[model samples]
Target chain A: MAYSDKVLDHYNNPRNVGSLDKADQNVGTGIVGAPECGDVMKLQIKVNDATGIIDEAKFKTFGCGSAIASSSLATEWLKGKTVDEAMAIKNTDIVNELSLPPVKIHCSVLAEDAIKAAINDYKAKGSTRKPAAGVEA
Target chain B: MRYYEALGLEPRLALDAGDLQKRFYDRSRQWHPDRFSTRPAAEQRTALEMTALINDAFRTLRDPAARAEYVLSENGLEASAQRGKDVPADLLEEVLELNMALEEADGAQVARSLGQFESMLAGVDGQLAGLFAAWDAAPSAGRLEPVRAALNRRKYIANLVRDARKTLETARET
Candidate 1:
């Protein structure tokens, strides 16, 4: 099947392809998979603690070109944005942007999952570590 | 949905491969997304995707070892990927020998190895069947982890054997 131009473009030149310092307080990492497609994706975000802003994002994915594109686009949307703003990124917007075929909709779902995973990771880790309390030794 | 529900089968341990194959073909002809290509574009697209899912599930369940692995996974257990490092020494030694022979075997030797491996696979499958029956009867969480690990081990070894057979077939064909 022919991939949409956007999918092909992202697949050819993927963006935000790397890993975050998972140790960082504001970092969120998401991992999701669909057994039907045998696809898995990991999305990570580094957020600025004081500002609650996303400073950077990265992702790793194992799947077809459409999955790659959706993730690439997600990270592109995530970077340089506040955590709240990033959370607002919608799967339907991605589906529209990529013009994903109905059969390929799962790719969009994976991307949305990555976004949520990254946010949850950041939240889980960020709230605990940020404002590091002085050790009353 | 339950696996049995997905396959439109009653939950049962033993199944007839020949009879199941006939049912599978009939289902494929009737409900496979490919048959809906001439329908609406949206419906066709849905059909195409569902067809792929059906095919994937069917292929996995049709094979004894793959089915075992999936059953293991359903219980939230996985065999170790670094099994060579993490597995018991005795198991490691056996796997190593099997792998080395598979790696070095000529096409004819590999074909012979495949027959031997099939018998071994059958043994593993029988063990898996017993394990599954036990799990179904008792449904013990305590047993699942270890059982899953063993099943995973079988799956990995089973996959390697299939890979070896494929390589041998390629060599013989060429």
Candidate 2:
């Protein structure tokens, strides 16, 4: 079947297609896969430490056009959004945007899941950091 | 259950091929549409359905990998395309690199990568064999988790091999 125009557009011009520094405390990396299709996706978000807003997002996906498009669009929507707002981005919206068929719906699901995983990683790191010992100048 | 019952056998992963063939032949003969011509229309329809089911069951059960997947789904541990999540991290990284190679490599490079992927697939299969034995011995949901995970790994490796071969073929055709 022919892909939607949006899907093709994103596939040909995938935005933010790279990896962030995963070891950075301010960056959260999400890695996910679909073993049945041999697809893998890695999404990362860099969040400002004090403001809780995402400053940048990047993704690397190993799959079909729909998967690449899905993650590419995911990163595009992530930048400049608050973590809470990003969490609200649903797979169905992506499906509608890309006009993904029922078969490709899982691709969108993978994208949404990657977003959540990245946010969780970011939160986990914050929680694990040592608290401030005292007031500073 | 339907397939095994149709063939007068138990649900088993290690079915004897000769026995399965004999059973399939016998059932096909009994349910053949020609034999039901003289019967009522309803009987003919039922016979047609049964014949179709028997054929499908035999085809699925004959393949070892398909049979394993069938057994897993039957036991509520379905190995669906949608259920692929939480793959081990190191393997995910390897898959990403392999995908990049497949995109940029020529026929010779693809062949080399294909060999490496095939070996990885074989290793996963060997691990699956051990897991299958463990599950067959005990047959519990807990024991099935590792088997399911192994199957996922096998599926990924198998798909990569298919992709690499396709890329090689396409390059050759050009």
Candidate 3:
């Protein structure tokens, strides 16, 4: 089946396609593998330490184009937001936004999951403030 | 039943594969269905069935684990299925507790727990393997299906844990 227009948009003009300084304590990085498909995704977020907001988000994905599009959309949704707000983001929304079919729905979910992993990595390392709102410093 | 019964000798399990292949080719020249395709219908059918039997026997003898399982099963020493169904209560408890933890966690928190869940999964895999071996050693067939069903449940639940982890990891992005 043909991809939805939104997925095509994200694929054609991917947002947040680069890396951030991984050494920053406030930044959490998530790298995940899809063993069944032998796919890999690297997602990163820079959270404001004091505010728990996401200042910048980026991704590097090595997989199908659907996966790449999903990551791009996810990064757009996450940037300039509080970590808590980002956490509230849903895979269903991504699917709806992309109008992904059942076969490619997993790609949207994968993107959502990559975001959560990055945030969780930050939380586990001990930043007490709940994820804040509006990522801009 | 004769190994050389091709020529009248016993088929040796330890025959080198290359030698076995050569011998099989030699026999096929005389007994192959390709040679009898234009012959009587009865002869063709017999040739087909014998060829199938020979190939089945060859494959069965080739794999060590399949051979062992076949031998034990034929001798009525197969592992009892019921032995695996009795999963320890503590393992069940652990599974339940982890499920509860994931249920209570938000997306970000659940992502944080994924690594731990992965390690837990490894342990579960080990337990399942041990149970399989133990059952194989038992003589009962009565509980085998139920035991396999329980193992399937564990596998299904493990997939859910993985799903939860994935949700936690990437929910924030979109």
Candidate 4:
């Protein structure tokens, strides 16, 4: 039942806790929930279109300390990473960094899912804005 | 299923409370340790085990939510096995928005949201009643799926209501 120091630290002072404009073409928002625990997490990333790097990340989570910490850490790792690099981020990395216990492993998975969902949303928006010019024509 | 077996009832979702109480008491008396005290040590052990199982069965089967969960687990649809993949996106969005509003809600706003959440809980419970009957009439995976989804939604809303009440109490105390 005891949380690791890292989890407590992030929990008490979660970084990048806020929201991004979902309507912005460059911003991707991911909202996910855990029915088992009644937890909801929202993670958003603003990608720098010119460089394809994530310049901003934010999260709002309503759940246990572990879930809040997981999403907080996720946003921190998300910023400054290119889209491809962000996609490679895994839940295990968050688990190791946060020292989450076995029961809290699902929190990390939720964070990873949020990251992927946000990226997918951003990519989906991009594909819609610009059609496949050469292939269709 | 074992709980149902322990109480000598079929594994069904709906049960009369009075009948269940009677069955529990009847089984408890039959397995009372006093009756087995004069018997062999093996018989005494069996009595002790039966007493525990009967108590557990009564406790679980009395609550509709817990009873549904028991049936789900027996059929390989355990709640813990669910990862929110089945949660509709619109529900998640609504939950997120409500949480955001709650963070900044004043006393009046909190009370309003509490009323809304309570009614939502009522709606979910009503849905559950219909689902339980549907499953009892004809048990099938298709029928159980909606029951599980409704249970998940109920759990989420229940948590919201609990937290909102706590927040309101704290606000009043301060």
Candidate 5:
């Protein structure tokens, strides 16, 4: 199948293609996979605690060109957005930007799911950590 | 179910390959187009269709993975319908780690890991066998759930193995 030029562009030069430290308290990691196609994607976001904004985003995906491009575009959109804004990002947005075909829509859905999972992970970590009571200046 | 009916067998996960082959051959002979050429046109068409179905059924049921997939589809658990929601967290982590390793590994490192990936594939196949037996012994939704999960894992590992092999081949050519 012919891939949209945008999809090929992101696939050839995927932005923010790397990893963030999963153990970091401020970093949220999302790992997801599509069983039907054996596609696996890992997207991570490092949120600025003080600004409540995502300062960095990284992703690694192993699948078809569409899957790679979806996650790559997702990371690009993720940076500079607050956690709330990131939550608003939808699969349809990715589909529209990438011009993904009907069959490849699931690739965009996977990216959306990764974003949610990462944010949830970040929130879970924040809630689990003890509050700084005595150390307050 | 048509595949099972074509082969004169019940819709079950586990099957005796030799018996299946025997049934296929017996049915193929019974419906062979050559034997129906003198019959009516409709009868000839039926013979041709039956032969085609038998051939397809044999090809699909002879392979363990294909057979399991057929059973799953028959039970309304299509592989393509599965999304990230059903994938276990640990399995995704392991697959991600393996992909990361493959990305960073040199030619020699990749070649070395090919063996590991093949062994992993074999291990998944063994797991599939056990799952198939479980479903055959006691047919239930619960029994088929693990079978689907195992098939997914098997597919992931198989893709990894294929990629690793392709990388090695490309290195050799270069």
Candidate 6:
């Protein structure tokens, strides 16, 4: 099947295709997969400890072109956004952005799930750590 | 759908190849369109439909993995494409590392990884066999969760192995 221009664009020049230090207390990691198609995606975020804003986002995906594109777009949208704003990012918006076919809609769902999982991980860890560098002790 | 019932046999995963073949042929004979040539239109249509269903059931039940999926579907547990998102963190970390090595490896390295992946898949298959037995001993929803989880892991391993094999094939060509 022919891929949409947006999908092809992202696939060829995928954004944020890397990993953060998963062991870092300040970094949140989200690893997701679709067993039916054997697609796995790992997305990570580093959050500003005090401001509650995402400082950086990265992703690595093993799947079809659409899956890769979906995750690439997700990371692009995640960076510099507040956790609440990131949470509001929905799979339907992603589907619309990529013009994903019905069959490939699950790829978008996976992306949204990875974003939420990462944010949740950040929240769980962000609570117990030292405050941001600029924050008062 | 009971694949065994569709073929008029008992529902057992350890079905004998000979018995399965015999049952399939016997069932086919009963639904053969040629035999229905003299029957009315509705009867002929029914025979054709039954024949198709029997063929599909036999094909699925003949393979271990496909048969397991069919059994899962029968128990109202449809395997979703999103099922692997919940794998344990440690396993996910290991798989990610393994994938990275595979992607960067050369011919010899890929060959070595193929062996490792095959062994890993074998271990998963062993686990699946145990789950299958567990399900057979007591076919309940509670037991099926582990079975489904095992199947999800197997799916991941299967894909990794497939990618490794493909890389090896390309290496050979070049």
Number of the top DockQ candidate: 5
Query: What is the C-alpha DockQ of each candidate?
Result: 0.02, 0.61, 0.02, 0.69, 0.80, 0.63
Off by over 4 Å in 4: A130-137
lDDT of 2 by residue, B91-147 (tens): 777777788778888789899999999999889878877776777677788877787
Q: What is the TM-score of chain B in candidate 2?
A: 0.86
Residue-by-residue lDDT tens digits, candidate 3, A1-137: 79878878877888888777767778787665442232446689998766567889988775567888888989988988998898998989888888888877667767777888888877776654444455542
Query: Pick by TM-score: which candidate is best?
Result: 4
Better of 2 and 6 by DockQ: 6
* C-alpha TM-score for every candidate: 0.54, 0.87, 0.44, 0.95, 0.93, 0.93
Supply candidate 5's per-residue lDDT for B51: 95
Docking class of 6: medium
Output DockQ, candidate 3: 0.02
Measured over the true interface residues after superposition, the C-alpha RMSD of each candidate is 11.5, 2.1, 14.6, 1.1, 0.8, 1.9
lDDT per residue as tens, model 4, A70-127: 9999999999999999999999999999999899999999999899989999998996
On the 0 to 100 scale, the lDDT of residue B169 in model 6 is 91
Better of 3 and 5 by TM-score: 5
> Which stretches of model 3 miss by more than 4 angstroms?
A127-137, B1-174
Pairs of colliding residues, candidate 1 = A28-A122
Instruction: Sort every candidate by TM-score, greatest first.
Output: 4, 6, 5, 2, 1, 3
The whole-model C-alpha lDDT of candidate 6 against the native structure comes to: 0.85
Cα lDDT, model 2, residue A89: 97
Clash pairs (backbone) in predicted model 5: none
Per-candidate Cα lDDT values, in order, are 0.70, 0.86, 0.64, 0.92, 0.93, 0.85
Model 3, span B92-138: residue lDDT tens:
33443455566678876687667776766676556655555555566
Which stretches of candidate 1 lie above 4 Å from their native place? Answer: A132-137, B1-13, B16-174
Per-model TM-score (chain A alone): 0.91, 0.93, 0.86, 0.93, 0.94, 0.94
Q: Which RMSD values do the candidates have, in order? A: 11.8, 3.0, 15.3, 2.6, 2.3, 1.9
How do the residues A16-46 of candidate 1 rate in per-residue lDDT, one tens digit apiece? 9877776766677776654443445668898
